[model samples]
Target: MDIIQDLEKRGLIQQTTDEEGLKNHLRNNQVTLYCGFDPTADSLHIGHLVPLIMLKRFQKAGHKPIALVGGGTGMIGDPSGRSTERSLNTTEVVKGYSEALRRQFNKILEVEENENSVVVRNNYEWLGQMTVIDFLRDAGKHFGINYMLAKESVSARIENGISFTEFSYMILQSLDFMKLYEEEDCTLQIGGSDQWGNITAGMELIRRSRENQDEDIKVYGLTVPLITKADGTKFGKTAGGAIWLDPEKTTPYEFYQFWINTDDRDVIKFIKYFTFLDENEIAELEEEVEKRPENRTAQKRLAEEMTKMVHDEQALEQAQKISRALFSGSLKQLSGSDIGQGFKDVPTYETAKEEIGLVDLLVNAKISSSKRQAREDIKNGAIYINGEREQEINYTIGADDRIEDRFTIIRRGKKKYFLIDFQ
Candidate 1:
């Protein structure tokens, strides 16, 4: 069995109407598949990663992929898998988000201009062109009001009241799929388990559109499991919100830390979901989990591989450098960028332009409980500047302490760190 079959064996296929037929189709020729991304955020969260990973897997197995950015349907938010009507975003915001997300998508898949590579498209191209009359005459005729309401996505939100705009969302999505099928010859649609309703709507539209022609335009829908932690809390979300693919939204170090700190129970499953490690490599990591759990070999590798895949080699290297520096109690070699990325979690304080004593600033930043303690630490050589011990109690922290004219990393005692952002 190949990788797709292997994925199926591992229960990665949460729902597919015709799995055997799809497999047979793959056996014959390169299947053109698509997964749509709504421009809900500037960067995709971990929730979006599942289908992207599936698309990546399909691409690896010799298939073409269409990454559809929902520029049109985003205006009319999909009610499927939601309890409430989504707050609408402006067209300008959605357009900007779509472009940013496309760049991130390019990083994960083979999106180059080749036959088997990926192609990015926006539904707005067609949907925007269609007037209300055209939409109602051409696309709206195919969908029934009763059929739309019966969908769990719509029905679940009806009691609370759903807007007509959101109710029509599925029709637009179906149109997107049908348009791709007609123009791009895209044969399969993949999404999370929550998207079954939209996927089936597209499949049904294909059937109805060809009923008069006596032709069967078969399309398949595949969904991967919605990722959840064993603790029953959401995955890829922290108190800070979603761990984004874009480094600017969530820094490389923070992103690395998110995966590195995954619960021990979820590490193996995460490896399957997030990384491209082969079965044997995963098994070996599982063994390491048993023999030397404290080393956290699996989690670190998972973080490294994913961070490198999403960001770049430089971000991954910086994350690792900061991790090592923080862990080994040696941060002397860290640069200004390293300090900003590494110590982001630590508290920060801004000192006035006038010279201020280090001990007083430490107290002001709450690195020490009191000025007395701050003075004691400074006198005892427990304070550090750019990771070097500073013993002088009267040492004035000034322009000289600035790193690359951006930051000053202050160390209190041994492990605690605070960053002074030099404005």
Candidate 2:
């Protein structure tokens, strides 16, 4: 199947303008399509995955994919899919964010020296150079108050007090589409479902701007459904915060675990959504999910693919190793850095390096309520230091017990783990 049909089968399309015409356009020539991503934060989250993947899909399908970083529009935050107005960031912050997003997109999309590689453009290049009079005369003249009000973004925020800055975001995005269309011959724009308004506004801009000219301008807009979970909980959110693409923000282990722990009901859908595995391979995994749900074969593949794609192979290997060691209750093979990366979120405490008995050490680390409970836990074989079962309360934690003399892992039971950092 073609990339367009494949995306539809995966349930990626939510709305599109001129679908048949766009299909024919793709069939005839290598269409240039763009999707704008506002750098609202320093790093893109899991919510941005579909659009990013869509760009890759198009590039692999012998088309030019332009990733528009909204350096200009991001200054005045997008009001789409928001219940309230956004807290605008400074120009400096937005610049930093834009650069950060650019680096990330460089990794995700194959935008290197290849001819069909993706192109990264910042709208601020054109928008920043234009004067207010030029903007009002060229772009603003095309948008009427009634037409702008009708857009879903403006309509929803109209009652809740929308600002002119955000209300004008649609026009800025529309200008982006028009600029790309004029300069790069980019004829298509893709975004999330909420972007239907801005995207159509762009298509309209392209059409109206070229009306007086003899050139035939045909542009299209396509939107993908908002990423959501089957259980109705918000996707890409955890107790800590958003799952950041930056490994420093969210470790590869944590990122892998997020997909690995996908619900049984949602795993199949996510495999189709996230993985490049063909239908036969996915179908076989689906069968595994049915026959051996306990094995979590589908979830494992999903995690592996996602981790390796987002991070490097070395990072994926470390993540898998960490997960395996944790599952098997063995940290002896893992280094200090590996242990720290894997257990970054686990309960941690610090203590001066000294000769300490197992019972006293447990009390010091707060892994036990008191010396009495620590004694009971040790005698009952629940105390484990660096993967070694310490049944005797007299067991002393020495320099040898520490993992590379930096950290020590203490397991109170089969699952309860605590990291004691040595000073």
Q: Name the candidate that leads on TM-score.
A: 2
Worst 10 residues of 2 by lDDT: 108-117
lDDT of 2 by residue, 135-236 (tens): 899999999999999999999998889999999999999999999998999999999999999999998988888889998788888999887788899999
Error of 1 at 393 (Å): 3.6
In order of appearance, the predictions have TM-scores of 0.93, 0.98
lDDT of 1 by residue, 1-423 (tens): 775577765567888879788888888978899999999889888778878878888888888888999988887898877787789999899999889888878887747767688888999999989999988987789999999889888888989999999988888899988999999988899998888888999988888878889676769998888787999998888998889888777899999999999888999988988788888999999999989999999999999988888888998999999888888767767788888788767899876555678878888888888989998998888888877888888889887777766677888777788888767
**Which pairs in model 1 have colliding backbones?**
none
